[model samples]
Structures are given as C-alpha cells and as structure tokens.
Target: MIDGALAPLRILHLEDSDLDAELIEAELENLEHPVVIERVMTRDAFAAAAVADRYDLILADYVLPTFDGVSALGIARAQCPDIPFVFCSGTLGEDLAVEALKNGATDYITKQRLDRMTRTVVRALAEARARADKRAAEAALQALNQTLEARIAERTRELAEANAALQAQIVERERAEEALRLAQRLEAVGQLTSGVAHDFNNLLTVIAGNIEFLERAVLDERSKRRLAMMRGAAARGASLTAQLLAFSRRQRLDPSPVSLNTTVASMRDLLQSSIGGAVRIETMLQPDLWPARVDATQIELVILNLAINARDAMAVGGRLIIETANVAVAAPPTRPERPSPGEYVMISVSDTGTGMPPEVLARVFEPFFTTKEVGKGSGLGLAQVYGFVKQSGGGIRIDTVPGEGTSIKVYLPRDETEADGDDVKPEPVDCAVRHPPGSTPVLLVVDDDAEVREVTATRLVETGYDVREAGSGLQALAFLEADPCIDLIVIDFAMPGMNGAEAATEIRRRWPALPVLFVTGFADTGALAQAGVVGADGIVQKPFRDGELERKVARMLSARQAPGLRLVADRGRRS
Candidate 1:
C-alpha cells in the first residue's frame, strides 16, 4: 500500500521568476521517487499555501518584486515551519546569505551554483520520508504483535480452563510464567525509553515553546502565516514527547481505586465511535472483580491506545475482547521474571489479527518502535502501558506469535479488605479565594532565563504590581536587601551563587513575614520538602499557567497574615 511507503516529499517554491520555479521543479522531477511541488510567485501566495500543510522543503528567491527573500523566508517559516528552507538567488550577496542562514534558513544556494540544489533537496526529502516510513512500520508491527499475542494467550487460557481442577494449578503457574517474561521485557524497555523521554521532553518543551513565541513575533503578514506550519511541527514534536513520557512513566498521574467494569461501561460509547463500525469490541467482566488502585484516566488512555492499535493490526476486520478477573499470588510465580506473590486484579485485552515475530516482540516497548509508516506512530503506546503498570506497583504480561492473535494482561496489586470495593470519588479542594485584587503587592520576579524574567516581570507590572527583576538567587537577595519593601518574592530554584532554598532561608531570617514562592523544573519533591518548602505555600513546578502562579502567590501572601500559619523555616534552621 502507498501508506506503507515513505511519505512523498512535498516542496513549496517561492520565486518571482517562473523560470527559477521551473528549473527547481525540473530538478526534483528527475529524482528517484515521486516528488510533489507547489509553486508561488508572491510572498502573499506562499504565506497562504504554507499553512495548508507541511512541506518537505521550501525554495525561495532572494529578491521578489514586492518582497525580499528575508520577508519570504519569514512568511514560509510562519506558515510551514521546521521544514528546511533554502534561498536560491543569482544576485544575493554571499554575506547576506550567510546572515540569512544564521537567522534560521536551512541553506542558501546561488542560481549559478544550482549543481548541488537537486542533491540537497533529494537528500533532505529522503531523510524526512525515511524517518516517517520507519515510524509507521514500527507502529504497525507493534499493533500486529499485540493483537496476535492476545489471541494466543486467550486460546491457551481456554484450553487450560477446560481441564477444571487439575489444570487450574497449571494455568495459574503459566500466568505467573507469562508475568515474569513481561516484567523482564518491561524493565528493559522502561530503562531505554525513560532516559530518552526525559531528555527529549526537556528539549521539546524548550523548542515548542520558543517556536510558538517566534511565531507571534513574525512581522510580515505573509511571514506570520508561515509560523503556523512551524507551530504544527512543534505541536507534533510535543505530542511525541508526551507519548515518550507516558511510556517512560515519567508523566504526572493521578491514581485512584477504580472498577474496570464501571469505567469501561462509561467509556463504551466513546470507544465504539473511536474504533469505527468495522471492528467489534467486546467486554467480559468477572462477576465480582476486585477494584484496583490506578489512574482511571490513564487506564482509559491505555485501553484506547491498545484498542486503536488492535484496529490497525486488523486491516480487514477483527474482534477485540477486554476481560477482567481476580487472582491470588501466594508466592512469586515459578517464572524467572515474575514478581513476589500477592493478591492481584487482572485486566486482559485480546485481539485476533496479524501477529509478530520474536525479534519484534523483544523490542516492542521501545520508544519510536513502530510498524506503521513514518509520521503515523510514535511507538510509545505499549511502552506507556508497561511504564504505568510498573510505576503503580503492578505487572504486565503478553503472549503471541506471527499470524496468530495476541493477549495482554495487566496485573495490579489488590487490596483484600476492600475487595468488594467502596465508593471512590475525587475530593475537590476549594481553591483559596482569588488573590485579593489589589496593587501587584510589590512583586519580585526571579528567573535564570532573562526572557522569562522579563516577560514575567512585565506581566506582573501589567497586573499593577511594582515589579523587581533578578536573574539569580543571589541577585534576588541583594535586591531584597536594598529594597526591604518587596512584599512578595517569586524565585526560580536552580540558580548560580545561591539556590532558591538558601536564598529563601536568608530571606526568612531577615524578613520573617515575607512570602516566597519557588519555581523549578526539578522533579525531586523530597528535596523541596526537606528544604522547608512543603505544602501549599512553597514550591511551584515550572511550565505553570499564569493563573496558577498568580493564585499561589496570592494564597501565600494571605497565609502570611493568618495568625496560626506556622513559619517552618526559622524552626527548621534552629533545629
């Protein structure tokens, strides 16, 4: 199928001269694979087209009748971003082209030097398409294998069920064996995805945020339009990072005790709509299954992800079965990779579809491992399921073979006394009253990033607060000392000279009544608490919403005036 092939390269050309466009089109036509070209003579035309969809490469002339290459470059960037852009001009100076490259153009090619133009275009397109194809294939294979494994496991279970009492022990033994194998697979996959997800997510956050910021700064109307394409690419990168984080189990989750039957029943309509009318989804809940502690939303995400994978695996049609049961693990199963014995709630998903080989199975949970074509799958679905289960103190098992179906079983630790289940509800906290609207209360904004500090300070000033800015913890303390009237201090945790904790300690010592809010990207909650910044009045993680920051600051300031609010810093320092 064409879907299995690398995505075709799409090129957009912005040149005032029709000859230049024709030349580029001719060059691309001679490439090995099919090349799609879209041409635009004016900056306005290019801007309008760039936002329609992503292009593999953009070729812009350095000079246009109404606009220059730089202006066109900006428009192309705004509308179809991150795709490589090359300035092809006969009259553009070498120095200017170099400057354009520095300003974010992928490459600058002179018309006389069009010899390498075809090669550059072909190479870039090939790389992009190859990546897209590889990703798609990995997703397809993972889905196929998962479906196959589910069916095989179900068949094995059924055969074991037929023997009744004698086979019961054997079935239990096999289940344990299966779990051990899954654990090993998960551990290996988890280690790899976790590291990649962590680093990749950090980078994505920066890239995506900055790209959006740049999009807003584009001056020309046409250039501004091109930012949308860049934004889309950034958004895709963000989504991929999110998948990686979920698979790595580094994603923040809200866990609760939930009944599989109830949750699935509620989501039936949504699931049915998602899978379409072609594929069948069946639910088989045990008469009295135990409630399991898990993130209900995440569990739903896992189920949906698995079901979508199943649907894809069965290109023609297939049955997807979701079942639940209870088991007691008295001792760790005999399987070499199994967990310690305990009560467990098992949720199994099975499907009948094209299966996978042993080689694919081994790397199934690796991030970016997919069978679908490039740009189709991020290859983090099962890896996410594995990470979620392991992080929540559970286990997962899978069994399958090529051409056969597949079954995946997730085993969560069971609470014996609450086996019958009690009403589970999320309690809502009445968020403290909106910060009393008043003068921005003498706000101090501290951040290592100059841009963040400036923006935040401007925002605060706009809110009517007399804002002071500091680039580091030491600088903040110096500012505070010189101006003791600073009513609120918003500090970034990671800073040179002195960290937020140390600065907070010093601030508290001199100005006991001062309210401090620490912002950080670090995930170590223990470290924050140990530094006497526990509870609602302390630290706020980075990437915070404007309202969250405002509210936290307001609440902390309000708490300072409360007679019973305990000052922990002084007590801790004394102890």
Candidate 2:
C-alpha cells in the first residue's frame, strides 16, 4: 500500500485565464488518483485560500494580470512551508524558469508541454505526504514525552506532600492506623499512575509501529535520523512507565528459588568495583543458606543500590559488610505490615559512615525524596527496593545512628514447595509466529480514538491483513455479529459504555473459539480478570513499538490454529 493512500491530493492554482485553469484541471484528472483543484484568478482569492484551506501543491502562472508567480510562491511558502510550489506558465523563458526554481519552486513548466505536469504533481504530492507523516509522528512523540515528564513532576510533588504529612503525624503522636491508611492512599496513587503509563504505552505502540513503516518507506539520511530520535523518545517513555509500576508494586514479575548467599557472593567483585576500593569490603556468607522465592534481577538491583548508597555515605574510607542468615520466626513481626511468621532468608548490609537523621530516615522510602544533590540521583533506589521486597512477600528493616553507621536487613520468604528440586521449568512457546502458507486472515480493530483506530487499521492493511475498524465496543460487537469471518479481534481495554473486556466476554459467548487480543493501558489483574482477560490470551500495551502489536496478533492467530501453544506471559519491567 502507498504511504498516503487515504490522503487526497489538494491543489491550489493561480491563473487569470479561465481556459488555462480548466486545462490544468483536465491535466490533473488525467492522473490515476483523484485531485481537488481550487482556482484563484486574483491575489485576494489566492491569499484567502492560502489562509483558510490546506493544499498539497500550489501551481502558479509565471505572469499573472495582477500578481506574478513569484508573489504567489512567496505567499504559499510563508503560509505552508512544507507544501510544494510549482510554476505552470505559458509565457515562461529558460532564464525566468531558472530564477523561479531558485526561488523555492518545485518545477517550472511551459503550457505547450503540459504533459510534464502529471509527473511533477505526483512527485510533489509524494514529498508532501512524507513531510506530513514526519510532522504527525513528531507531534505524537512530543506529546507522549511531555506527558511522561509532567507525570514524573506530579509524582514528586505528591511524595513531598506525603513527607510533610508524615512529619506532622510525628509531632501529634497519631495512631498507627492513620499511617496505614496514608500508605493505602499512596498505593492508590501508584495504581492510578500505573494505569496512565499503561495507556501511554498503548499510544507509543501505535506511534512506534507507524514509524517503522515510515522508516522503510523513506531513504533519506535526515529522515531516518529524525525517526530514530522519535523511537528513542518513545523508548524513554516506556522506561519511565515501567519504573512507576515498579514503585507501585503492580509490575508483573517472574519469581524463582534463589540462594541469597550465592547471589551476594556472585556480585562481590562487581559491587567492589562499583563502590570503589576506598571502602573496604567484607562478606559473611552463612553456610547452607535457605533459598528465597524472588526475581533475581530485582534482588541484584536491591543489593547494588544499597551498596552504592553505603559507598556514598562514607565520604572517606570505611568498612562495608554484607551478611546472610537463615532464620525462623515463631512470633509475629513488630510492624503489622511486615512479612508473616515463617522461615526466611535474611540478607543484611552494614556500613561505618555518617548515617541519616531521624527526619531523613522517615521519608527515605518515599518516591523522588532524595538527599543527594540535583542531577546526582533520581531518589527511586530505596523506593524500588521497598516495593520489590513487599511485592515479593518480603520485609525490610532499617537501623541507623546520626554519625556512627547504618544497617539494613531484607527478609525474603523461603521457597519450601516440593518443586524446589533441581528441575528447570519449560519455556513458553514463541508468540512471534508467522501466518500459514497462502492464508489471508481478517482482523477487527476497536478503539475510541479515531486517529489510533485509523492508523492501526492502515498499518495492519499494509502487513497483508484484511483490516476492519470500529469506534466503540458496541460497534465492534455489531460488526462481529454481522461478519462471522473475522479471524482475530484487537480491542481497547478502557472505553465508554461497553469496554474491551465486556466486548470480549460477549464475543466469547457467541464465537467460543475465536482469538482475541486486548490493547490496553490498564495493568490491574483483578480488573482484567473481571473483563475476561488472561495471561494466556495475548495483550499489547498502549504506546507499544511498531512490531509488537503485529507479532502479538500473528501469534494469537497461530495459537488458535494449534492448541497447546503457550506465550511468554510477562512483557518484563524496566527500572
């Protein structure tokens, strides 16, 4: 499919002769595609059309009764710089054509050979379409990046306010229940932030997908570079959203049995180098340490973040100790929010350096509350640690003095299930499946946003799929009931009246075996379950990359053909 298959070719012609204007219109109609021509015989008509309407190409006669081609070209250039301008005159000389070409005209042609006008108009329209696509991609990327930045700023302010509230509670000797409720409120904010990030991801997915197509359609080095920048910005936005989800304890994770002692031992050399040789390092690894169920990558980050913080605390040289232990707690924890009574793998880190004061310690785990100078830290390290531990069914304790030192302990629940045996879990089937031989599948895309729905449909059509679109879930249901040949359904999660999940349920009731792929900005499992969504079924988040949705759609369709095919559930989170 062509890049601008749906975009119409709009032309603005400046010619005082009615016969010449009609000739130009006839020439335009001779081309394969439809063209809309607006003729202006006077400078006032041309000026009014230039401001009031948008055009793909401007064709002006070299010599007009009132204004020349140069004047019209100037006006078009100033009003719509990206639009193409060309000279179509009967009394044009070689020298005059060269001068006009020098003055931003696309191409100069004589009336005797009006046949050349066809090729010129085609080339100009192609370039104009390319520019329009680039501008639209840039605008979408800019809007997403700005949103990511604004959300980060807003989160920071909320953290600061929570800190102030905590300090006030300390002065008034408020009950512990109040603190618990405050924590719940913070959790609610995290949930809201996560949802917004999910939606942003969906948007990015659409933008990124179209960008990939645009990159292949264009060959210029500058256009490729600009698209690469837009891709980078989209990637950065994805990272920001993942970090927010991590802090909120809503990010999907894959946990396994891991030995705390061995994990720390493996990172000894790396941590030593990361913290520098100035601080002496010591490890007290307990023999036969119990295994804990956690995400090793996240655990490694927690340890590294603590080590980095310890190194920074000691301005000069100091001793840093990392120790592990296996403990069983018979009684309940001092804090009700801590982990339950059970066997746990305890990992502790201690440092001999200047410690945080009472006020600083109180707000240490709050997101974006950093003590380090500006540009030095993001203030998400400890917050991430806290969220990871809690989400992994673990607890964290902090003990510190004003100037002596600080010790932090992390307790992870022991994995004592029978499957703790030395056996590897089988990996899921690859979801990047290709279509079968000589198969042209049909796809139905449902979304409330018109731009997203149209772009998504256009992209799918480009990829060899018969694509149909609907503005809402009700419309999608109506289409599904009427057309029973659609092989797959791609629907948005959040919508007015009937939502993606509701639509999925209704479809399942009618078309029991049909495959459905949800495009959503929501990360809540309970809400998804209520909407009949599962990890087994494919899901593509908002603001996803160009290839992501296609791969997922193809995978879902393939999985439908062959049962017992599984997909990698988690999309994986970024810090």
lDDT by residue for model 1 (196-260), tens: 76787788788878877887787887877677777787687777767766766678877665766
lDDT score at residue 168, model 1, on the 0-100 scale: 79
By summed lDDT, the worst window of 10 consecutive residues in model 1 runs over 566-575
lDDT of 2 by residue, 382-500 (tens): 77787888889888778899799999888888876512554433234332243344558879998988888887888789989989877666556545433445678888888876678
For each candidate in turn, the TM-score is: 0.40, 0.41
Q: Where does candidate 1 stray beyond 4 Å?
A: 1-192, 219-221, 330-340, 415-417, 420-575
Which portions of model 2 show Cα errors greater than 4 Å?
Answer: 1-175, 330-337, 418-575
- For model 1, state the Cα shift of residue 144 in Å: 65
Return the lDDT, model 2, position 384: 78
lDDT of 2 at 82: 82
